[model samples]
Target: MGGPNLEVFKFGFYIMFPIGIMYYFGTNLDSKFSVDGFWPSKEQSNKIPTEPEDIRAELERLRRRRLERRATRLAEETRSQQDMAGDGA
Candidate 1:
């Protein structure tokens, strides 16, 4: 009565078989046919500032510009909506 049943082990393997095969082939194919954006190219790498202060300043500048642009866009959208509502009334 103490002997382990082999059916349980077979079922476990059956459940894992497809998952293991997929993981293996997926990683293999990813390595073999890696596209351009998988790793950054030289020009892409060059675009990043090397100094910490420069990186921070660049990020801050980008954030400020993005916020300004977003504010302007939101302002314009609201104005247009208001104009539409006024005309419809």
Candidate 2:
């Protein structure tokens, strides 16, 4: 290949190669900064609910919520029926 300025290109690579290698590894030379963010500082133990009374209370609350939702749906359905009857006139 009879390319002009080939010596300049060769010199540029020689100069930049060491800088690139340093940038790739020098800043992370410290072991502390090289790790990911998942290092734990606190207890990670799984906590299961320990009280039967708490479970019973939660169940009662959920049952109340379900009954309220059913009542609201039934009320809205009845209101839609009245609206349809009025529209048919």
Candidate 3:
């Protein structure tokens, strides 16, 4: 049978080994002195207007322009084909 001394040593080593390693490597004192403080007084502009209704209106205008251009191109293609057919017949 193992003695009580061996059991105590095993428990102490299991608990203290990780805490000792963490204490030794975790605290970096030199890097704490070299940090620059943040500038807290910078002026920033609110350039973007955050209106969803204005965005929706602009999107609808773009959609209408795109559909108008597509319809115009299709109508011009159809007219050219009709003119070519009439000239051949």
Best by TM-score: 1
| TM-scores, each model vs. reference | 0.47, 0.46, 0.44
As for lDDT, the candidate ahead, 1 or 3, is 1
Which of 1 and 3 is the better model by TM-score? 1
Computed on alpha carbons, the lDDT of every model, listed in order, comes to 0.88, 0.83, 0.83
Off by over 4 Å in 2: 1-48
Name the regions of candidate 3 deviating beyond 4 angstroms. 1-49
TM-score, structure 1 vs. true: 0.47
Mind giving the per-residue lDDT tens digits that candidate 1 earns over 37-79?
8787787785778899999999999999999999999999999
Candidate 2 residue 32 C-alpha distance from true site, Å: 16
Per-residue lDDT of candidate 2, residues 1-89 (tens digit): 74657878888999999999888877757673666655665466544456998778877988999999999999999999999999999
lDDT of candidate 3 over 1-89, digit per residue (tens)? 68999999999999999999888776785575445555444455333436998788877988999999999999999999999999999
Query: What is the descending lDDT order?
Result: 1, 2, 3
Question: Superposing all C-alpha atoms, what RMSD in Å does each candidate have to the true structure?
Answer: 6.4, 8.0, 11.0
* lDDT of candidate model 3 versus the reference: 0.83
Spell out the clash pairs found in candidate 1: none
